[model samples]
Target: MVGRTNIETGKVTRETALAAFSYRLKTAVAPLVPCAAAMERLHRGARHRILSKGDHILRAGTVADEVFFVHQGLLRYYFNDPNDGGQERTGQFFDEGIVVTDAESFLARVPAKQNFEALETSSIIVLPRTVLNAGYDADHAIDRFGRLMLEEALVGSQRRASRLLTLQPEDRYRLFVETRPEIARRVPQYLIASYLGLTPESLSRIRRRIAGQVG
Candidate 1:
């Protein structure tokens, strides 16, 4: 699906087109772009899905066979705490250009403890894990893509752990503002508080302090 050819002809070969398109998608959907051909194959089969606010893309206790690349909108990842009478503890938020999925469920083929829900009306490209894995088996480049993606995922997990372990509520809020401004601007304050490991009341204090308005 990707590549270029003789410049004089001003036409592209299949290989050239695939290479070009795969290169473009790599930054956003890395592992899936094993090569121009593989990526094109997946693209042709890609399904677009729309989710309204509050819709759940995935639920706790269910296996997720799909991973979604956001075309537009926001998603929140959370877990229900039975001990807290089914309160949802938001773990993370994602938006356009982000990949939203229950990675654990996709990788392990087990039920996910986390829930993936739309925070706003959203459009996404759904990629079946089965197709991805089959591609990985067929192409060395695709296999490398999978490995690299996992490495990136691990790094992200480590960063979250570092934040939870070392940063105070106020500092965490500041960091969140700096790194994920869209989330802070769009998501509800209470959900943001849950992500920051604070109650809504604590979040209010943090916000007022940041505004230089706390008494």
Candidate 2:
């Protein structure tokens, strides 16, 4: 969502209105921003945890408590489809410099809408939802920042949904790699394949073909 550009023009759109608004709030808010006082206050009670591979950060139907900022490793955001006999697919991969949270749960205070799990051993810095809400209520700047984050998240979801319906499988994989180069390397092939909506065997063949061309 952050680095996306218009496919037709390739022009950088990083300074779009939503991004500017989010940036202003993220840097200006007292308790949620990066000012010295805010940093000190936030660091005082924040918790950091190391999650092993396959650890569930949040499971569907469960309540989510904290928003996680990824410090290291990869995480797969996915869910099981009961109608399809409980098949799982990687909806997205969260990597370093990315914030991974169950947005539906965090925003609505309801059960998680999907499952989040670490694909590899990872470390994350977490701040409780209560802390975020307190900061949001106390600072209009923080509330604006939250809204921007939600807007970006929704845009990303919509794009992914559209791509899944319209793009070819290989094109989807290529676009995913172009967008998330770090994740393309950090996550396993099978997981990446799932995220691209391809079978493992087809993914392997595609990898070999691509490698051959590079060679």
Please report the candidate that would top lDDT against the real structure: 1
Q: CA lDDT of 215 in candidate 2?
A: 100
lDDT of 1: 0.74
CA RMSD per model (angstroms): 7.8, 9.3
Where in model 2 is the C-alpha error above 4 Å? 1-39, 212-215
Q: What is the per-residue lDDT of model 2 for residues 18-57, given as tens digits with 9 covering 90 to 100?
A: 2432343465344544444543444554576667788988
Give per-residue CA lDDT, model 1, range 59-116, as digits (tens): 9898999877665568888998899999889988877655557888888889999998
Per-candidate TM-score against the hidden true structure: 0.81, 0.77
Local distance difference test values of all predictions, in order:
0.74, 0.70
The residue pairs found clashing in candidate 2 are none
